[model samples]
Target: MDFNENFVLGCSAIGAGLAVIAGIGPGVGQGIAAGHGAAAVGRNPGARSEIMSTMLLGQAVAETTGLYGLLVAMLLLFVKPLVG
Candidate 1:
């Protein structure tokens, strides 16, 4: 590969890696949320349904960040927008 091609590939790889790093935040956040949800459920069994629904909704929203990262990494790898 020419220098330009190599450079593009390198940059794409780096960007994809950086994009994937976004997953860590969601992962940690989800874990913390789950822990709190479990604690809440334990403290108030009567409100389990409400707590579960709210937890699920918040987790789903948080999960979107990881999904966005995945999409960005996939685009960088497969779309190759930087290349001619």
Candidate 2:
């Protein structure tokens, strides 16, 4: 490969790595929410609906950062700027 191609590939690899770094935040946050939901359910058998709703909302918020990472990786993988 040309020197320029090598540079681009290196940058793309870095970009992909950077994008995936967001995964850590969401993973930890979602795990926290799940743990809390499980504890709440265990403590109160009649509040499953409320606990599930809260868990879903928290998980959805956590998912946003991960989605951004996925978008960046997709762009790097399939949306090259050059045509030739």
- RMSD to native for every prediction? 2.3, 2.8
lDDT of model 2 at position 62: 82
Worst 10 residues of 2 by lDDT: 75-84
Residue 39 in model 1: shift from native, Å? 0.4
Q: TM-score of each candidate?
A: 0.86, 0.82
lDDT of each: 0.93, 0.85
Error of 1 at 80 (Å): 0.8
Highest TM-score: which candidate?
1
Off by over 4 Å in 2: 1-3, 82-84
lDDT for residue 5 in candidate 2, whole number 0-100: 74
Q: Per-residue error at 75 for model 1, in Å?
A: 0.6
Report the lDDT of model 1 for residue 16.
96
Total backbone collisions, model 2: 0
Model 1 residue runs over 4 Å out of place are none
The digit string of per-residue lDDT tens for model 2 on 1-84 reads 545776787788778889888898899989999998999999997999999998999899889989899888878867854323
Error of 2 at 60 (Å): 0.8
Error (Å) of candidate 2 at residue 4 is 1.7
